[model samples]
Target: MANAIWHQWVGCEYRVLKTAKENIVSQRSASPVLSSYARLQRFILTALLCWTVFTPGAVQASEELHYALTVNVNFGQDLGQPLGSLFEVRDSQGEVVLGAGFASVYNTMLQGNRHELQLYLHGDRDEALEISSLPRPSPAMGTFITAYNGELLANAMNYGSPMVWDSASTTWREDTTAPRYYQTPVASGNLVFRPSQVEYQGRTIFASERTTALFFYGAGNLFAWEEGESDLSKAKVHAVPWTPDRDRADMDHAATLELATSSAFPYCYGVLDNEVLMVSNLGWLYGFDGEQWRLIQDNSGNVFQMYTMLNVYDRLLLGNFPTGGIYAWDGNTLEFVSAPLDYAHSGMFEAQTFALYGGDLYVGMWPWGELWRYSVLDNEWNLAARLFSHPERDSDLLTPYRSLLRTEFPSREYSSHSLGQRVYSLLPLSGSLYASTSARSGRDGRDIFHFLSQQELDQYGAVHRITAPTEASAQIRWTGEPTTFVLEVHSDSLRILQDGVE
Candidate 1:
């Protein structure tokens, strides 16, 4: 009953079959689109009327089973729309936990211990959520925190030099105190921490967005890229020891060693097959085995310029920037899975974000806000859900909840704005999928979350049962498009095989 919370009047039944047929005939003769739609409707009627005989409880069981159909209606006036909730934080127990606009979420173990869920707020005051409680997220602590690695590592971003977080003193201080006296070079400006990182032993390796530097912090040593690049031709990776007394100018720069210079900056890094893989925004993939750097040759060039990587089901999946589709690396090579490569019309065929839930891989599509699911057995991407519903885009009817949003706030500046038209982030938590939207037109976006029901997961047919207006004389009003209705009955009455025989 996951999708039970979201439903509308999906189907209708009628007794005036004679009047309905007459209206269909008149509408079909007027428009070609209607002609096509009528033909499809006829096919559905043929199958329904043929099944005149039914068991005693067959009709009653249909009601309980929610035997509804999806009718391809191009135009329909708004009926009494069912309502749902706005953006509200809910916990594992389906309780309202917190209410705030969160932009990003990261699930990690704080220092390989305390389980924590980090939430980045939407406002500009540099705030985040620290939830030490796992599974059930409640009583979250809102603190002025920066990039963290357990009780170690230093304050990142604008909080100053890589200072360690003092759990005892509850302050951001120099790393020369007790426990571990670790020192890392001063990080450059505008440093944004990526959610993915490689943490082993005492060393924590993470990359940044704008800088061509890879941060390395471990065992009293901090190796980070200098504020400025030494060489513009190649990407620079360096390390420095943590010395509390020594000044920046007094430190020796000769200890810095370059990892790779082929690419200027390493924007993305993750574990692919247990090895640390680094990719540059300029199109190059490298693998480091704690010793030498191996260039993972991507002959197809699909792995180049990837922004996101997820190792799922023993497969290294890569999501591209703005041109390429989702690709998987099979140890030796990478292959294309699915893409809307008609760039002129489809825009950029890239996945903005991804989530894995219920044995299905859901990817948040870019430019279109399409939520597509990848089935492991089927090995295909199916349209599971959408953030926005436009008649020109999808043939499915808008959920009553979504229709309410469209009708109430149809413009940009409205208080209750649209869920934009693009999904920037997706998080599957507590058996529900939460999505954050992005506005392509530089407008404000909204956050909405929902769960999919069983019926939505297994949609076998598109049903339409149009009833003619009461008795007197009815005229059916239809459009140009053919309304094709397909019925998926669980009977061996008809079968169309490969040879075109029924």
Candidate 2:
């Protein structure tokens, strides 16, 4: 048998109800929050995913069926996580693959930076391979890195300019020998390269200048320069105004837009049908063709600032900022669907990014810096932290600027110390989902070091990884009456049931 891992979340009471050759059940007690946990244990953990990533190469030798594994868990009432002890999951060589219990209620790293959420599929391959694409926004991933055309590409956050990871060595080589991607009238500061550019027709598109303007990357820059825009880099394949390719572009058929709103930044972009839908922070939706632009919906004054755009479920789902909800756009009509960011007393936030994995939609939430999973099979949204280890914020979690960051990070809405939090980017790399974050507060800016503290900085940037806890640390005290927990594995898939109720 191949080595396997199982993550059992917090639940009530325990006992081994059945044990047989075909069916084996394991029981453990649930513990309370760590001794230092401040939430008072009001919120117990719900569901967790099971894995199918192990022994992918060994299974399906006949291309029909070869193996199946099932593990069941039962818990007693009032199970708690009060051990307040730190532990690790180590490999045979003694390297810790996972560590948690840094002042947590569940002692699980559910509140940390990254997690490899299990996809329960019993097959010869990993299910993460099914995820095709995801938004790679620059905000969440302070130094977000991506891959394109088989080469590793990274942003300009650490390096002054865009960088490419040397497949040969540990060093990163500058993509453009020039110091920058753009040569401005003076200087364009530092441009965070959003590698996820959407391609339409022959034009590949991304936004810059605060997304107030859209830049097209193509063979020729067939557009007239917007008066204030800058020029492109030395490798001028990207078609934009004021670039070398401008000479090859037709001045008459220039790609220019006459948007309905005044100076609105395109914070969100989604591909619906064949049209690229651009939604501004102020709720103005527009559809763009190679030559023509059409205003889709004008919610300009409605204050429905949408931050994230996802083309999923045959529709464009816009993450509304103020309402902390989602707006569904089916090309013909656009309306509010549901508020899945059901965090503490909510006011305004940025539902920043979205990714699809294991037949579910996962959202990168902001101001609280959390990730939520929406299950299509259950028709419900569940707070599933597929990655990270921070203490769950209290229900009344709010900040100074209406609990939101300044519209601009350097904006003078609040002091420079509190820039707010974000799950920033839910990027799909290789065959798995990788995430990055924009923490609520930290030493982000070089000069603003004095504004932050060591405690805040410590919480900001630790890379956390979690695995199934060892049996020694699995036992806990009681918290409630007995419920149910079940794990069923077949030759094709794995299924889990919590609260012992199936």
Number of the top-ranking candidate, with lDDT as the measure: 2
Residue 363 error for model 2, in Å? Answer: 0.4
- Once fitted onto the true fold, the runs of candidate 1 whose alpha carbons sit more than 4 angstroms away are 1-263, 298-304, 322-324, 340-347, 389-421, 440-502
| Residue-wise C-alpha lDDT for candidate 2, range 326-400, written one tens digit per residue | 777777788878767555225656566665443345676766556676654345667766333333454455532
Q: Which ten residues in a row have the lowest lDDT in candidate 1?
A: 51-60
Computed on alpha carbons, the lDDT of every model, listed in order, comes to: 0.32, 0.37
Best by TM-score: 2
In Å, residue 425's CA in model 2 sits off its true spot by: 1.3
Q: Over all chains combined, what TM-score does candidate 2 have?
A: 0.50
Quote the positional error of residue 279 for candidate 2 in Å. Answer: 1.2
lDDT of 2 at 157: 38
